[model samples]
Target: MKNNLRGKIREFLASEDGKVSVKAPLTLGVVTGGIFLAQAIIGPTSATACPCQHDWQCPNPPHICSVGTCIGG
Candidate 1:
């Protein structure tokens, strides 16, 4: 029984249908990789400063903590 199952599995793997199944994951991987690479290259659109509790906690000078965010005017 095990040998029969193994033979069927081997036959499936050797078929063109198996090759088609492999392409979907490969395409998805490529697209996912491209998105990551684009993000790495382009970076975030806006700087996201850490939430601030005090004015001193803000990284930039002349910036104040208001509503948990740093604002510079």
Candidate 2:
């Protein structure tokens, strides 16, 4: 029974499906790593809304204080 199980394992390892089983995780890891690396390099994409009472309080141009929050630009 032990020998039979060993033979079955060996046969599975030699099959094309076994090759794909090994490669799939490797491919997924590489893709996931690449996405993380890209995000790290690119930095944050959105600006955080800051509390403000007037337009001038918002330092960056084109942004304006509206409803006590900085928005638009």
Local distance difference test, candidate 1: 0.80
The 0-to-1 C-alpha lDDT of every candidate, in the order given, reads 0.80, 0.79
Q: Write the per-residue lDDT of candidate 2 for residues 40-72, one digit (tens) a residue.
A: 998865544456788877758798888888878
Residue 38, model 2, lDDT? 98
TM-score, per-candidate, Cα-based:
0.41, 0.41
State the displacement of the C-alpha of residue 18, model 1, in Å, after optimal TM-score superposition. Answer: 2.4
lDDT of 1 by residue, 1-73 (tens): 9999999988876788865787667889999999999989987654455577888776577888899988896
Q: Work out how many backbone clashes candidate 2 has.
A: 0
